[model samples]
Target chain A: MRLRLTPRDTSFFDLLADSASHLVVGANLLSELLGADRAGRKAIAKKLADVEHAADEATHSIMRRLNSTFVTPFDRDDISGLASALDDCMDFMEEAGDLIVLYKLDELPARVSDQIQVLQRCAELTADAMPHLRSMGDLTDYWVEVNSLENQADKIHRKLLAQMFDEIADPIQLMKLKEVVETLELAADAFETVANMVETIALKES
Target chain B: MRLRLTPRDTSFFDLLADSASHLVVGANLLSELLGADRAGRKAIAKKLADVEHAADEATHSIMRRLNSTFVTPFDRDDISGLASALDDCMDFMEEAGDLIVLYKLDELPARVSDQIQVLQRCAELTADAMPHLRSMGDLTDYWVEVNSLENQADKIHRKLLAQMFDEIADPIQLMKLKEVVETLELAADAFETVANMVETIALKES
Candidate 1:
């Protein structure tokens, strides 16, 4: 039997869910930046930055709450892990967009867009799953789906790498694209890490 | 003023300290691989892998102990953070070395060696600081110095990126070198993260 305590503030899950929503916005901005005209690139990146800042604020709230609240909704470690992973996903999205702006790449490869699509799905899935934590409901599907998306992203990433080396002839451009792709890959990896954390918590709770 | 309980296992610190020491060995092998001739590259990478496997074993031991022990030497979060960061450092080092062998580069630029040297210093400093974690004695300098080293690495990293764009001609070669340099940069970043974790623990304990 498990001892249950009513959380003074259920707002923790709300904040985390809000952060995940921010990631969706950031992911969309990134995907849009890839296909958008050159003139609109900076605007997209700035919007992505705004989303990242909001996520940062949300993460700080979680941390502050974790420190102040004697009785949390779940383990402090799990809360912190989820918050940090969400923040990292946002950070990597912002980074990939920033690299595009910084490098002034006229166009990103099509597969890059595919990876961003995976990120958007992961973000949405995470947001949907956050509220369920209050009940410690079944999250196996959430994590399993996220992991599947990550594997798709990884496949796209590998193909992109091979294409970059096999076909791209200019060293400077290859270097620039490499950074963007790698950042995207890191975001995908961070999302999977978040899923893994959720799975760990679910196993411990259920 | 604070209540303390004697931990069932003091060996957790010993395991973590051992992992940090393994990082030093891994860093050295990485550095040696850069300077060594092609004939010896495989040997160096294999040695680095051995060190990584040893670090992995130590990290697993720490995790097992955390699961079993009720009263840990410090917060389980801090212990896990330190161990994960240490493991990440080793992963990045091995990655950088493997990229070298996979790329089959005849020679690496001098600044990469400079970055590896910084890694060596960071590894040594982390190994030195892990034991002091038991006492929660003055760790201000450890983190501060590690942060300083990271700054130096960032400088070297930026210079290398600029130099790569300015000097390197082959796109495929540039991609390979960039991966190695970025991995090394990540290793430095991981070290800073470990330092930051140490500082967090010290503040909480003190």
Candidate 2:
């Protein structure tokens, strides 16, 4: 682990991490809805909203932690970045849910499914990376891998955009798809941010 | 007065701040070219190009500082947000340069000028706000003032958007105007992000 804090410092990372996973949970629900029947879609959408709302509360908790605690487990900057990055991941998930509702996407998008898989993978990486921050010999490998996932997200994002523009001749559809793809990529970017902060922390710990 | 850093911290804050103000200089120069005479307009456009280039350099420098530094004068997240916000402001100025070049808008736009003025004011406030972040006693007043500036920027953004939609008759023209105005407003939102980060830091510092 890169960071070697006593158990007291672990809670902050744990809470931040729980929030990060919750965002992934929200994304999972959203992805499931994409594949579900109409009734199931509606139900899953509602569930996704609930998850997103909970994620908001989680963000508040982290923010409160950020304010009250002075001797943070790690660098104060890393804590702030981690918290904001987690919140941003959730924000993107919520945006994806709302966008699904707004666009009334009748079926799951293949690209969206692909993107969600990437999001989930990164979430797992984030969860895994936290513990290693405590005194890991080297996390550059994890950092690099996480960056790769972000790039994969970017790949799908660009492909989806191109598909949207190429396959859908409608300007309005193009715009809508552009916004959706952008939001998805943004979610991945948040993960990349977490990765970047993690790398910084790793450097310090090393 | 609100921020409470040692004198050493102030020097770094000053550097980050100088980067921000330098972009405003670009904006101010760009504003002048808006209503310039034929040769004067061309001269100002070139000058705007130089300012835009300088902003790019500033952004690079800020990010480099982020990469190398361990103990920041301010919170890491605040630095990140401020760096982005500062770049965003410069981006707004760059877009103005693009608009000037694209539209052949020789005369300074009242609306554009208004937006630029607001932006300069916002940048100045942001510069002022950072110094206050380490001190908490006067934090409330500064935050209120920053919020007020943000509000003013929002109002202006709305009015500019309304003007774009209503007065611009041609579709192509509308597209150009909309992009410019929206970019400017987005820049304002970026500044607001900085303010919000500052408030968060203040809450922690206090």
Candidate 3:
């Protein structure tokens, strides 16, 4: 079950999706640095920073749209919650990247990239849910998928952290690994928040 | 320029501070283990767990009080936020203790114990601020002292974290040290959140 909305709702929802998309790219770019050169890692981190900055701008626009428009998609708090949740995800991702750079981590493990991919897909799936949000419809599938991706990210995160302590020998590297992995997991948590909020809003609309 | 309230508001405020006071004692007990016996540490951790459980119950009562009792000592949200924030501080403190046991961390740094003292003082200062929350009517002294204590805790948090990095030899220990210190900082951050909330309430009341 869901509620129906006009084109204006569609536009705002689309922009929100776009904002999430940019943030997802930023999060993935952070992981994309795993098998990269010192220069490559540095470059990717910068790209992440760039996208992160763009995501901030997108969030501001979303807020503006939220304040001005009257007839909207879903509840106002839901819209605002979605924006803040996406922003939090990006914030955690960017912080993970910054930690990697700050701690001078040379090579990232394979699992970090896997989590990043999951994060990217979650953002994409969440975007897909937005159009559905415009019309009162079955959002169970969307919410479930978003949550599934986040759970996958969670698995990847736990494995990475355990490996950091169990397998990694370099103490400095372990320190860096622990922080980055925790930060990555926080991003997943942020995505989960978004999914949960969406499910609640969808239920309300229905 | 603060809103004046009756003594009844002050007592309602005391319940929140009293919960935090219990947490302060738990924190002191947790930190005392750095110099105590093995059995003592375990006992203290258990005691802290008990305090944490009680704090949650107190928080729930405060929330119920807010909802059912229309005329709160202060604004409903202000009381609500203070109660919740105190709970968060206790949660982090309890979690940090849980990690210590889970990780089997043998000895805590002296600096951490020092931070506990700072945190306890912050809690005390926080408790003192509630009576002054409604207005500065001869209460500027307490308000100013609360802000000063919060600033002091912030500095201690930063310095203690830096000292931790300089002292730990093992990389794994370094990782754990960083996590513990960050949590401690977060504990202090919780106090700061309360102080900021109190300050805002004071300003509005004034």
Candidate 4:
């Protein structure tokens, strides 16, 4: 047990967790969008957009708290960085969903589903890990796992790129699919960034 | 004149300037590549890669100095953030150049040059602004100009996208050209990020 003279504001943990929880919902919505027809995807995408807006509000709350608070649980920039990175996870997922509807892409490469699964797992792990910032314990596994998941996501992305160029005959279709795939890859990278920030915080605290 | 008890390490300014100078070389190389023949484009891209590699080393030096030195000129994360952002600008420029070569894109849309021109200006402005960081003086113009330039780049990017999709009939050609254009747009965004970081630092220091 540890003791402190000044009580640190701990609500950042809840805000961060709240922000990450959106990623899980966003990723699952993306997965659902993949299975739905055009009309269904449009509906699912709208829901995803609403969730993204909510996530943005959550991130703003974290930022407002960070600016007003004098004694932070961790470094100020790290708190902001963590919040922004979490927001990015939601943004990219939301973008991927939107592009699918905007481009009216009827078919996506099969591996795109693999990409979403990785994001879902990352979101779950990140949401689970935010509370641990208080203890700074049992975090090594979370970061390590997210790092490995990102690597897997990278492999899938490259392979999907190769597969798309090799098989997709219509150039316009190829363009739309490529953009959507790349956006999903960006989402995976964002999750990795969040995990790395958590690793930095945990290491500093340890 | 500002008086301080501890003398801050001033070399970070020079190191950052050195990193940013590579962007000037890189954006020039990219511009030159756009005008070159296929073989010439390949050679110019190789040169740009070397410049990018050198820029990477410059960024690493900043990171190493930041880690070993106790006192930085600004917030430690801000320093790292600026360094990473500068590196990203170079990376995106290099990728745009490389894709031009790899895809063998013979005739890019005319607006593509406008995108590179924006980058060239941004790079020059960024290299110029890094030294001002030491003084934290005369920086408002730098960020303001870069932000405006980014807005210009965004408009150019959207026009280029519409122009390409409208005029280019072959989907494959459009894919190659679009990737190059998007990468340049990203480079411009990265420069804006560096400018934003500078703005944050100057405000904090003030």
Candidate 5:
């Protein structure tokens, strides 16, 4: 490891970690929403919205700190990029949940749970990985695993699309489910984007 | 304008301008596809796919140059970011065209054409703005107009969605048209992202 002559502000890492933690909460709420009744889904989506708001605040704080500080732990743009990417993950997840509620969709396909499960795994992995940014150690596995998970999510998404097209006769219902599924896929993609950003940062720092 | 002592490599501007020019072609092809019948759409979509491939090549060229060159006219990351954003515009437009063919959508909403018109305008504005990067003159109008165009696209998108839900009784047809419309909107948003990145670069430069 290279040594630093001057101390860098470390709160950025904490703020990032905080931002990612909200994703975990949001993802879990999405999972819960999948299992809930309509009323239950509404409550869970509300909670997810609250978590999304908190995540937004976390991102804004990071941005505020980034602008105020001359020296950063890494490139200013990367910090903002990572932060924006994390916020995207939450926004997609929250949007998925809201669509589930708004469409009043009853009986989503079984594979949708599979989609949420992938998101949960991604969120957990991402949240676990954020604190490691300081040392930039043990991050290869984190990004590699997230990349692999995203592949799994993609396969699930394609299969789910095919299944929906095959089984659902109702187009409106299909539209609603497809939107939710696509939004979830976007969330998974966002997670991969974060992983990719982290990989870029790690390579640059190394 | 700030004066620089060191000579900067200028080919980046040319490559970027070339990239944006492809967007004009792609967007126009999209407009043609909307007007075409099934056979014509397939032919046009094939052509659009070719354009998308060409755009991809342009983007890759930018990346290759970025990697090989030491001195760039602007921040290396900003150049890459702008290139990627431009590529996204083509991807979404190409996807919209492909879906139009794949789903065999016959009668699209009038507002769908409105969406493409907005994309056409954004593409023209973006293509026009890219050459100005060398001088960094008259770019504020470009980004500002693109931003306003994106807002118009969003409004059209929401109205189209509501209209499709209210008017289309065939669920499958609704699904196909809605996907196409949303993808076009994504193309519009990608243009805005490019504009936003340009704005950021211009600010930093100024």
Candidate 6:
């Protein structure tokens, strides 16, 4: 057997970590936009656009690296899945924020606060865990925490949906709130996917 | 530079094609579920579950192959992504069907028929494209058609959403219909993701 000497470019991990960090920024902004007034929310949304753009650039960097590199530190599929899932989380965050601004939703259900908080926790944990991907050590806790947070978010989602359908009178307002909440729920789901990807990689490597 | 002699396992393509075919099955059943009455829809949803289970098995086969194979016909990312995206399509399809049954929705918007038609077209195109993936010939048109179908589905989704929020008076009923439509929209989005993945692979390989 011929000995292979191609060096694994580890920069991809850094880029992924950078992308996860951007998710934290976007998720926090989403939480802030939930309570902001019209003008404030618009400004926050603009800031969110910047965050999403940064995450996009990070994702593009990852794709470029994947295309050029011959050998990766881990399977390319895991890397691609992680990058895309992180990008998705940011996209949903941006969508939720933009919906609030576009729909002019002045008031939201009370449980939205709890849901956003769960998202913020998921983001922070994602950012924290990404760096450890290089070592593939002590990462189970990250995914477990994210999974727990996602479950918490799901409970909030179900309760909020039930309350909206049962209590709201105006269909238009109900639809608007539902869209906003559902987007957040999707973002949470995406974060869970990312966590699952991380778990898969860790299991394979360990 | 040293030449390598390990044979690339190509069965991944077959498994992915199998998964895509299952998506076609699930999507067709979804179209049927929309037109189905109370008892008939439950039966259809059960059938969708079986399709989803088959797709899940196909996905697991891909994962097992990825774990054991040293060399793949294409980038492992594309293989795994294609499999997962196809699985997601079935999942969302199943979710939409189950929502219809669980929510006991008697009637959906007329525009939903158009959405289901677009999904059927996408499914057929995806199934046709999977066989060509091995040769990487004449696949561009497949992704192109899937993209066009997705765009058509988007238009229908927007119209349905607008109608739901504008016309529906009962919040509970509106809520059920919205969930059903949103799940179908998500399945359509998953199809677009699959198309994009195929395009990515085609661009890289050819």
Off by over 4 Å in 5: A1-5, A14-71, A75-81, A94-106, A110-132, A135-167, A192-206, B1-6, B39-70, B109-111, B137-172, B196-206
lDDT, candidate 2, A21-90, per-residue tens: 7866777786787787676777887888788778767766776676677567776656766777777787
Q: Of 5 and 6, which scores higher on lDDT? A: 5
**Ranking of all candidate structures by their TM-score, best first:** 4, 5, 1, 6, 2, 3
Stretches of candidate 2 off by over 4 Å are: A1-8, A36-57, A103-109, A131-145, B1-84, B90-134, B140-178, B196-206
Give the runs in model 1 whose Cα sits over 4 Å from its true position.
A1-9, A37-61, A137-179, B1-15, B18-121, B136-159, B192-206
Off by over 4 Å in 3: A1-58, A66-82, A94-167, A188-206, B1-15, B18-22, B38-43, B53-77, B131-139, B154-168
DockQ of each: 0.20, 0.12, 0.13, 0.16, 0.17, 0.17
List, residue by residue over A67-88, the lDDT tens digit for candidate 6.
6777889977678778989998
Please give the lDDT score for candidate 4.
0.89
Pairs of residues clashing in candidate 5: none
- Candidate with better lDDT, 1 vs 4: 4
**Model 3 C-alpha lDDT versus the unseen true structure:** 0.72
Instruction: Report the C-alpha lDDT of model 3 over B39-133, residue by residue, as the tens digit.
Output: 66677778888888888788767755654563666666567667878887887787666556545577777667776776777767766665555
Residue-pair clashes per prediction, in order, are 0, 22, 8, 0, 0, 0
Taking the tens digit of each residue's C-alpha lDDT, what string does model 6 give over B75-153? Answer: 8877887888888888988998899899998888899888888888888888888888888899767866886787578
Candidate 5 global CA lDDT score: 0.91
- Single out the weakest 10-residue window by summed lDDT for candidate 4 chain B: B63-72
For each candidate, give the interface RMSD after superposing the true interface residues on Cα: 4.1, 5.4, 7.8, 3.7, 3.5, 4.3
Cα error of candidate 5 at position A48, Å: 7.7
Q: Residue by residue across B64-105, what tens digits does model 4's lDDT show?
A: 687577777887778877888899899899878877876678
Name the docking class for model 4.
incorrect
lDDT, candidate 1, B157-206, per-residue tens: 86787677667887677888888988999999999889867766765565
Q: What shift in Å separates residue B106 of candidate 3 from its native position after superposition?
A: 2.5
Comparison by TM-score, 3 against 4, better one: 4
- Model 2 lDDT tens row, B1-206: 58845333344565676676676677577667665776787778787778777767876777777777767766776676667777776777677666666776443336767776776776677766655654545655555676677667766765665455445555555556656666766666666666666667676666
- Residue-level lDDT of model 4, residues A1-206, one tens digit each, is 89887889998888998998888899899999999999999999999999999999999999999989988999898899999999999999999999999999988878999999998999999999998888898987897799789868977876787678778888778878988999999999999889867865764555
Docking class of 6: incorrect
